[model samples]
Target: MKTTIEKFAGDTEGVSYELTVFRFKGTSKTAPSAYIQAALHAGELPGVVAIHALMPKLRAAEAEGRILGDITIVPAANPVGRAQYVFGELEGRFHLGTRTNFNRDFPLLDRPDKAALPPPPRNATVDVHLKRLLVGLSVGHDIVLDLHCDDEGVPYLYVPAQLWPAMQDCAAAMGVEAVILWDGESGAAFEEAAIHPWLQLPAEKAPLEGRVVTTVEFRGLADVYDRYARTDAEGIYRLLATRGVIGDAKAARPRKFSGVAAPIDRVELISMPRAGAILFHVEPGRSVRKGARLATIVHTPGEPDGSIDILAPQAGYVLTRVSKRSGRAGDDIIKLIGEARSARPKAGALED
Candidate 1:
């Protein structure tokens, strides 16, 4: 195991970000290589803590000569976002300067090789440069995991449609509650950028069966706990072993995915009709019948019919809800996986 510091100039003078990369060398060249990054949004710490717990296991494997393939880890992927504190809370999802999502708009190359990436523009923002650096570090790996978390939700994964069923083992190994398969475009998100190059080539050049790439939503934002971290770590370790990155005989086999798996279009992005405080009736991992009351918005506080009930669009599985109690008009409040495709489905990401 060796540590490498990746530094880049900030947008302004005397400001810069230092990204730490940890590498684990393998003895065998035939084994698959993996790259795991956490907290691309910076404040999402569940994956970071999981990686912390996983380091010891990797070290043990390294000491015992069990590491068969090269592995790279970046526990805290965004130092810039980590430093962005507005008033009191951490604003890690979008960059302050560019106001762009940290995980979106990544450079999509035509090939899996990093050399195909062109140099960043002279007038590009710091976030743009950061995206390029992340791509350069993560491209061409057999496995790439970008760790993120929803506002409030059960553990889930956003896997490209091309990798479904093949990636079912990954979902099972990670012990997530659901899997959302997406195709076409996701505003060129990191997951899309990671797999786009491979999709351009023939299967003979880049086999889909052996490749693993995903955006793992490890429960919710406030779910950072010691036990959960350890459990998530064990899950990731099991995946590495299952992929032959590490030779671990004791790791339990991944079970069949027993959770809900559906296309991204199956998600019902329920929005608030009016601005008000939200009162949720269902939590994550719950199933709802058609027209079931999911939440209520107190739009006008003192009137008898002040609150408006937000019902289920259809019979579906409740996947997530917003962390905040209040919302403006048309704010996306919850994600429910419906039995059928959404009537009004949009392309790209679920949200901006």
Candidate 2:
């Protein structure tokens, strides 16, 4: 296994973004290759552990000559977001000045205009150019696994529906039963852009023909040295083996909630509209009826405090809730999973 760090774009007096590569060579060109990246949002640390554990296995596979194809691992993919800090707290999710989510704004090529290309020839200009860049770096193989984790909860995989069965086989090897399908509506998430959206394009537009490209999401913020982290790492290695990049995957015991799942149809981000002290009336994961008491917001500045009771606007399952006691206006208090409904102009405002 040979590791090299190359500067792709930004590197200045104080800022640098380097692409870290771990290459493991296979004897035949027929073998499949794998790519893995982590820490796009630096605060999500499980993926960092997942990639770190994958490295030693890659090295072992290389030494044993068990490698079936080339493998590339990038443990830290975003240096800019990873280095951001605010008031001693690591603020790695957004760009400091712009406040833009670093994971958003992925670039994509426009579909070719019919006039530009005749029937016999397809418009492969844009994606071809884009693929040329990624392929040139790892010219020998096929497959890319962009790993990630949420801020607070369970593990899941975002597999593009187009690449089903093939990628499904790959996912199943990790005993991953649930997949959060990216049906083209999860706006601008890096994995959605790189893996799922590419799968949606027509054959002429897609760059990968038969390769498996998908992402794995481990459970949310928790102990780095916890058993869950170790379990997640092992699952990744098993996935590598099933892809023919390594030897047999270690046996793993599936968790309680191990199974395929669909992404929530709607995300009702409940937040307070006024500065107040929060008091919860319901726990997370509870199904609440419309108009039921959900929580209470109180203005507790003086001895005699005034409070406003908050109620659920619709029936839904509470996916998450804020634990903080105090909240400012517009701070997210909870996120409810709800039934599909038409888009409203001020949809989010209703929740707040």
Candidate 3:
């Protein structure tokens, strides 16, 4: 239950981020050491609520010496984003001035050559820097959970496909109903950029060699500071318990969703040819057929109202749709998902 506040290098507003660590003082090391970070995207708030609710229980676990190894939790991980707003509307999703999503751009560092280290006595900030230091800190852990929430949609699990069935089982144990196995290349995402090098086998190897990492989406945006977010917190707590970070066996166990990994084959993003006010005809997590009427744009007078129909593309499940009713041209529509369909679009189709 100890906490430390450190100022990030680029922070100018005097806002400090707290990093809390919980562990039993006198206990044997546990199998899984983990980290939890929330509020990376300020507008997406559920993770904040989830962490607050889980903290008291974590403290109790620490007092009872049930906590095994280190578990770090950073609830308000992005103070800058949290503070960004305009006329009561959240401007936190994108950078205020540049309009860029902060979560999309983190620094990437490649592995350093063994011979490159000058006896570990580098005096320069560039050599012994925060990026290198954080990388070193993360390499020792079993798992890193980056807590996130969608702007509007059902909760889903996002893990590097490299982790496979173990991660799938873990997600189900945490009560995550839908899991998306993402194989696309990630850029500058906080969780991915921080640990991707360690997960790689070599320069361009297919298999990862180190610990498993995942970014979990709990639900939609705007509920982070509230009580309902506890669902995700409890789910993560169960996951930690199952991994042996906490001593309670009952807390560690949970019911499984049959064929947890099989449904992952169905997740797909249906893009719009042109975007306008997104009229959603189908809600999230529903089953839809191919060529079903998904949404109809409200046509303005004197203009051809472009009608958008979301075909399930393949017969499968629907996970989530665009949260905001209004959309600019070229935005993505609901992500129509179904199990493992070869008809899924290739990478180039998604590229601009």
Candidate 4:
């Protein structure tokens, strides 16, 4: 087990932030390697805890010489977001200075030429530097897992369309409740940026068989607990074993996963019509019929007949909901995973 700290120049003078990486070296150079990161959105702590639980097992494997390939773990991927706080509220999703999402607009390198790359600004923000450093570390790995969590939701995965059935084992190992496949350039997210170059290469020349990348959402914010973390960690270990990164003790175990996988566009975002207090009628992972009452908004709390009901537009599973009880008009209150629904925008970005 080896630890390395990568320092990135901060936005302000004399300030800096560091990313800690844990590496477990393997014997074979051609063996599959993996990069796992947690808390890119610092407020999402479930992945952080889960990674903590995963480390001990990895250490045990290291001692037993069961590790077949290199493994890298970044327990906390965003120091900037982790430190962001205003008036007692943690603002970790987007940069406060630039109002840009921390996960969006990452640098994409399709070729090895430096001339083809866009010139950096004379004074880039801290977020840009952070993105560059993070992407640089993950670019060559055979497998990349960016662990995150939704505002409030069940365990789900965001995968690229090209990696579908191949990633089913990973999804099954994680025990994810849902998988959403997307393709093309959406918003230059980290996963896309890291995997795009290889995907762009000619099929005959590219080593497509060795690459696997996906973003794992480890349920909701409030779902952070020891039991969940341990379960998630064990699932990740099983995934590693199944992938041949570790020995095949847990890998030989039968699959117990029972989740639905669908295209990203098929997952509908049910938004609120008016601002009000929300009362949810359904929980995450629950099945719902089309036109079933999903939630109710008290738009005018003191007035008679002040409530408005939000119904499911299609028959599917309730994958997630907004974390806050109060929301404004047009706010996405619920997310449904339905079959054969009209596709949303095909751009590769995730819904915020």
Candidate achieving the largest TM-score: 1
Quote each prediction's TM-score.
0.98, 0.70, 0.79, 0.94
Candidate 4 displacement at residue 8 in angstroms: 1.8
lDDT preference between candidates 1 and 4, better one = 1
lDDT of 4 by residue, 31-65 (tens): 78888999988899999999999999999988988
Scored by lDDT, model 4 comes in at: 0.84
Q: Taking the tens digit of each residue's C-alpha lDDT, what string does model 1 give over 302-348?
A: 99999999999899999999999999998999999999999987677
lDDT of 2 at 288: 85
> Per-residue lDDT for 75 in model 3?
70
After superposition, the stretches of candidate 2 with alpha carbons farther than 4 Å from their true spots are 8-17, 109-142, 164-178, 185-187, 196-212, 249-260, 263-267, 279-325, 338-352
Of candidate 3, the 10-residue stretch with the lowest lDDT total is 112-121
User: lDDT (0-100) at residue 69 of candidate 1?
Assistant: 92
**Of candidates 4 and 2, the better by TM-score:** 4
For model 4, give the 10-residue run with minimal summed lDDT.
Answer: 111-120
- Candidate 3, residues 1-352: lDDT per residue as tens digits? 6666644432345534333334233255535677777766766778878888889888888888888867766676665566677898776656664455666644454542222223323442221232333334344466677777775666777776667665755777667757766564655565665456555446355234335577777767754545566777788888878777777888876556553343343556776656556677888767777767777664353466546554556666666676778766657766666656636644411211
Positional deviation of 60 in candidate 2, in angstroms? 2.1
The lDDT, on a scale of 0 to 1, for candidate 3 is: 0.61
Residue 327 of model 4 has an lDDT of 92
Residue runs of model 1 more than 4 Å from their true location after superposition: 252-254
Better of 2 and 4 by lDDT: 4
Clashing residue pairs in candidate 4 (N, C-alpha, C atoms within 3 angstroms): 186-348, 186-349
The deviation in Å at residue 27 for candidate 1 is 1.6
**Deviation in Å, model 3, residue 323 alpha carbon:** 2.2
